[model samples]
Target chain A: METEKGKTFRYLREKREVSQDAKDRLREFNRAKKEILGALKEKDMTVNELGKKLDRPGHEIMFYLMTLVKYGSVEAGDIDDMDEYFSYKLKK
Target chain B: MSDEIRAASYDALVIGGGIAGGEAALDLANNGYKVLLVEKDLSIGGKMILLSKVFPTLDCAACITTPKVSEISRHPGITVFTGAEVTSIEKKGEREFETAVTKRPRYVVEEDCTACQLCEEVCPVVVHDEYQYRLVGRKAAFIPFSIASPRVAAIDIENCTLCGACEKACPPKCIDFTQETEKYIIKTGTVIVATGFKLFDPLKIPRYGYGVYKNVLTSMEMERQLAPTRPFNTILRPGDGKMPDRIAYVLCTGSRDDTIGNPVCSQICCMYSLKQAQLLMGALPMADVTIYYINIRSFGKGFEEFYEQAKGMGISFVKGKVGKITETETGNLILRYEDINENRVMEEEHDMVVLAVGVLPNTDPLSFFRNGELKADQFSFVDQAEVLSSPARTSVKGVFVAGTASGPMDIPDSILSAGAASSEAISYLKQ
Candidate 1:
C-alpha cells in the first residue's frame, strides 16, 4: 500500500542494494561500535572522553552512542560537571 | 477509523509538539483526558530537539525531549497529528469547540515507511538542511532528524524529481508520491495553543552583516555546530573549512532594538549565548571565545551562577554595543563597538562571529479563529487572561496559551506554562 515514490525513497534510504558500498559502510560501522564497546568495557566515559579515547569526532561518537543507547548497549548516567556534560556507561 | 469517527472524539487538543505541547499533552492524558496533539512539522521533538544542550543545566536537549516525545507517541490517551495545522476553530454547543485540521501529504506512507535513511542516500536532489539550521545539506526525501518520532521519512514533494527513483529503491515499496492533502474535523472541550516562537532573522540588521559575511553566523548555527549530530566534525568557519581559533558572540542582535520594533528583551538569548560559548570551549579547546553585550541579564534560577562559571572558564565578557561588522579579505569579521568600561571605541577581529538573535511570537490566533474569540496582544502573542498570575488561560473561554506562544521565556518556564495550561484545561472540563 506504499506509494512508488516512498518505495524508491526507502530503497535509497536503506541503501541495501549497494552491495560493495553497503558492506564497506557496515564494516566501518561495526568497527566503530566495537571500539566504543571496548572503550566502555573498562570505564564509564562521556561522549567527549570516548571520542578522545577512540580518536574520533564527538559528533560521530554521538551517532554511535544513540544507536548503542537505542539497542541497550549503553546507558547515559548523571551530569558530569555542573551540567556541562553527561557521562555514559556500558549497560550491565 | 472512518472520517466521522475521527472528527468527533477528543477531550482536548494541544496545538504544537514542542516541549510545551508534549508536556501539556502528557499532563492532560495522565489526567484521563483524550488529547489530540497537532504538530506543524513532520516530527514532534520541535526546535529544542535540534539543540545541543539547554541553558544553565546543559542537559542534552535531545535526551530530555525524546523521552517525552516517545511517551506521547505510546500514550493511549493521546493522538498525534504530524505535518498538520489547525485551519479554523469555532465554538459549538456552548462549551465544545469544533476545529478544522489540514494535513499535507507525507509522500512516503507513515506506517509502511521505515526510517532506514537509505531513500535519502539515493535521492539526487540536495537542499539546505533546515533541521541543521541550514548549516548543512540533506536529501529532498528525508527524515527530519535522528530521533524523529515514528522514525518515518517525509518527502519534500515540491522539490522532488518524481523520477520514481525513490520508489524503485524502497524495500517495502512504501514511497508513495500520490498522497493528497487531507482535511478533518475534530471536537474538543478545551484548547491549548503552544505554537512556540521563531528566532528573529539576523539578516534584519544589516550592520552585523549576517548573510553578507560568511563568518558571521547566528547563535543557532553555532549551536548546531556543537550539536552531537552536526554537519561538521569540528568547529570550522563557514566561509572555509578552516577551524576558527577566535570566535565572538554579539548579544542582543534582534532584541531590545527600538529601530527594529522589537523593544522587549528576549529573555533567554544571554544565557543561551553563554551556553554556546561554554560548549565552543569544549568543541575547540584552543579557540578564544568573547561575548559582547550591552547588558548581561541572568535572571533565572542558577543563571547568575552559570554566568560566573562561564567567566571563570575564561570567556571574555565585553560590556559594549556592536555597531558594525565588516569582513576582511581573509574572511575574518571585524567588529566595531564601543567598550563602555574603557570609554573607548574598539575594533576586534574574530575568525567567526555569532549573532544572539531574539525570539518573536510565531502565531497569529486570528488566522485560526474568524470570530476573533481567541485573541492576541499588540506583540501578537496570544494574550493570557491573567498575565501576573495565570500563565495559560487565554481571553476566550475554553482556550489557553503556553510556552513562547505567550512571550519569551526559557525551557523550564515553557514546561511550567504547559503544566499550568493543562491544569486550566482539566479544571475547565470538570466545570
Candidate 2:
C-alpha cells in the first residue's frame, strides 16, 4: 500500500499527467533489457546458458524469455517433444 | 607625492579594462601609441578572468587573460588606471578628445599593500564581492580575488560601516579612510569604448526561478560556483546543501526571445553551457547533467569537436526548449521541456538547475558619452554597420566600441574586434 505522501505524490503526478515513478522504472527495465539482448546477440544460447550468463534464476530467465517471445522481443527455434532446453536469439 | 591634480595626455583612451579594452591597449601600445586604460575595478583582469575556462578549446580563461593583464601593466606606452572611472568625454578638437577620469581612494597605499591580508583578517565588516559574482563574501578591505593582478586590496566604502578595525590592524599604517578621490584631465587623440557586456539578469525570466530558488543559478553564478577558489568549492545544491544527483541546464533564458525583446542568439551561450556541463560532471562524477538547447551553434573552429567531447563525457544533449522550471516539494527542480525528436512534452526532475543566461550591452557606456556623439540601439551600444564588418565603430569618428557592446559575441570575437578597434584608432589618429 502507498503511504499518504506517496498517495499525494501520485495524485499530483496524475493531475500533471506525468509519472515519475513509471518513467524511472521503464528506464531501468529498458537498460536491463538492452544488456540481456546484447548478450543474446553476441552468441546463440540455451535457456540455462543465458540464465547463468545473466546471473538470474532459471525460472526468472524463463519468465523474461516467455515475455520476450510473446512480445516478439526474441526468436526461438522449434522445441522437439523430448528436447531438454530451448535455444533463443535476439530479434533484429 | 603631493595631493594635487595631475593633467596628462595620451594617444588613445580605453574606457574599459576588459578583454576588448585590454587587447586594444596592448595592440595600440605595441604599435607605438601612448594609451591610458581606465578600469573601475582594482585590477586590469576583467570578467573573463573570473570565468573558469573558455569554450571550444576549453583553455584556462585566466591563463589566457592574465598574460594580457601583465602585458598592459608592463607596456611602456600604456598606463593602467585601476580603480578609476571616466567621468566625461568631451571632443575638444577635430581629432582630440578630453576625458575627465576620477580615481577612487584605495585606502591602502598601492606600493605598501603587501597583500598580507592582515587587514582583511581583522576587518569586522564582510560584504558580498561583486567580482566573484557574489558567491562569497569578502572583508571590507579585501582583494577582489586570489589572482588580482596588482595584488592590492580595495575598500568598499559603501559597506565600510565606519568599522576601523582594518585601519587599526594595518602593520604599515597604509589604511587611511581619509584618502580623497582625485580627478585627471586626459587629452587623447582617440577614445575606444570597450565597456564589454553584462550578463542578463535571470530574475526577468521568472520561469527559471533563479533569484527565487536557491538551487537554481545563472550561468555566471555557476561559473563562480565551479571555480577552484569558490567559497564551497563543491557542486552542492544551495537549497538542501546536498550534492545534486541530477542537474539541468536551460538555454536561451533571456536571449533569442522576442517576448523579452532580445531576439539575437547569444553566440557563446550554447558552447559555454556545454562547457559548464562538462565541468559539473568533473566536479560531481556521479551526477547526471542534461543540457536543454534549441540549436547547438558550433560555428567556431574546433567547436564541433568540443561539442562531441562533451557528448563523449556522458553529458546528455536534449534538443528541446525548456518551458518552465519549478521546484518540487522535495526541493528538486522539475523541468518541463519538449522532446523535439519525439514531439512529446517531457518532464524531468533534478536536484539543481542552471539557466544559460545571455549577455546584454553594458548600459553605462551610453550614459557616459554625450547625446549626438554616440548612438546605441535599444539593447545599448551602437548598431553594427554590417554583419561581417567590425561591430566596434561608433557614429563619432574618434570613438569606437568593441566586444558585446555591439552585439552578442564570444571571447575570441571580442578579442579580435578589440584588435580591429585598435587598428582603427591608430588609423584615425594618423589621419
Candidate 3:
C-alpha cells in the first residue's frame, strides 16, 4: 500500500541525514498547518480570528495564512467592513 | 549554460549583477569583448529590481530592469553565472587574472525547470521571503521573482526538509536532491568590482524599536509593499493588516551619524523616501504622509524639483530627527523626536513608521582577491586611487570598482560609474 509519494519520501528520508530535532519541529509545524486548514474548512476567518481560535499570535497566523494562499491551499477575500483585515478561506 | 562558461576564457570578469555589473557586462560585450558576470544571488537584478520606482523620474523599476536583464541574458558575448560566488581571485601572470568561483546548487535543474511552480505548491515548509523583505512567505522551492532572467526555480536547500513533495510534484522532474555545488576557474584579462551595498540593519539601533514594534518597518519593507508584485492585496500594515491612516517616515536611521560609526550621508535615501511618499499618496489617497528628516539632500538631476513636487502634493516635510519609537497597545507607533524648527521635543502617533535605513559597503568582493587586498576607504567602500580623473581605478592595477562598491550613488550615477569601469577595463585589456 506504499504509494509513489510515500515511497519517494521514504527513500529521501534514508538518503538525507535529517536530525531528530528537525523532524520533531517539522511534525509540530505540520500539526499547526493541519489545524489552520481544518479551521478554514469550517469557516472563512481573519488572521486575528484564527489567532484567537488557535491561541497563536496574529502575526504567526498571518504568515501561515499567506503561505497557504501562495500555494493555493487558501484564498484571501475582501477586507472586513472596517477595512482592516482580509478574510482567508480554503481554496474552492 | 555553465558549460559554455567553463570552456572559454573571458576578456573581462564583472563581479556583482546589480545595475552597475549588468551595465559593465553589456558595455564590454557590446564592444565585441567576451565577458563573464557573476552574481551571488539567485537573480541578476539586484536591489534595483526590488524597488518600487526610481527617484525623480517615477518610472516603473521593473520596466527599466526587465529589458536590461533580458538584454544581458540574451547577449552572445556575456556569460552570466547566477547563484555563484567568486571564491578567490589571484593574478596568474602580468596580464591575466585567475578567478575561482563556485556555483551553489539550485536543487532544481535550471535547464529542465519550466517554472511551472507546482513544486512550490507541494513544498510544506514556509519561510521568510527575502525578496518581499520577509513581509510574506515563500516555499522551499521558489522562483526568485516574477521577472527572474532565467525564469528558473531554485530550492532553498537550507530550509528544505527532504520531504520529496516537490520532487513528486514537479512535472519536469528537475528536482534533484543529490545535486552538488559546481566549481569553475575563469581566466580573464580585467576585473570590474560592482558588488552593490547592503542596507544598514535598523535592528542595530535599539531605540528605534525596529524589531520591537511590529508597525515600525524598514524603508525597504515599505518599498516591497509599494512594488508592483506586493505581498498583500493592498497596502496593509503588517501588525494587523489595517490600512494605515497616518504614516510617518524616519530618515537617516543608520547613516550620517557619528555615534553609529557611519558618518557619511547615504545619497539616495532622501529622494527615495520622497518618491515613496508620492507613490503612497496615489496608493492610499485618503492617508496622511509625514516625513521627519534632519535635512532633505536632493542633489541629483531634477531631484530638487522632485522634492518640491512632493511638497506640492501635500506631503508634510517636518524638519526633525526621530530619536526613538515605541509601539502602542493597538500596534500603532509613537515617534519621539526633537523638532528642530520648533526647538523642542515632540511626540507624534501614527499607524506605521518606516525607518529610512542607510547603505553600507558590502566588502565581500574585496575579500575575494587572494594576491592582494583591494584598498578600501574608511567606511569600507572600495577606495579609488585617482577619484577625480579615474574614479574606477582601484589600488589593484587591473581591478576596477564601480557603483556603490566605490560609494553610495543613484542608479544613473551607478550606470555612469559602470561605464567608466568598463572603459578602464577595456583599456587595461588592450595593454
What CA RMSD would you report for each candidate? 9.5, 19.2, 3.1
Candidate 2 off by > 4 Å: A1-92, B1-6, B385-391
Candidate 2 residue lDDT tens string, B1-431:
23676799999999889888899998999999899999988887778888988887778888888887888888899998898998888887867898888998786678887888887776555444576565444656788788877788777765554445666677776665546688898999999988877778888878777867777988887898787666442554555334677888899889999888788788989899989999888887878899998899988988999999999999998999988888786668899889998899999998889888988777777666666557777666555554366456687778887776787788888888888888888888898
Model 1 bad stretches (over 4 Å): A1-92, B1-6
TM-score ranking, best first: 3, 1, 2
Error of 1 at A25 (Å): 27
Writing each residue's lDDT as its tens digit, candidate 3 over B1-431 gives 23434544789999999999999999999999999999999999889988989989999999999999999999999999999999889887756888989888787778898999888877777778999888888877789888887889988866778778888888877876655678788888999999999899988899988877778889999998999898876787777667888999999888999898899899989999999999999998988999999999998789999999999999998899998888888889888989998999999999999899998999897788764578888889999999999999998889999899998899999999999999999998888
lDDT of 1 at A77: 69
Candidates 1 onward: DockQ, in order: 0.08, 0.01, 0.35
lDDT of 1 by residue, B90-131 (tens): 887545989999888787778888787778767655555788
Better of 2 and 3 by DockQ: 3
Q: Which of 1 and 3 is ahead in lDDT?
A: 3
TM-score of chain A of each: 0.77, 0.63, 0.77
TM-score of each: 0.82, 0.79, 0.94
Task: Grade the docking of candidate 2.
Answer: incorrect
**Which residue pairs does candidate 2 place in steric collision?**
none
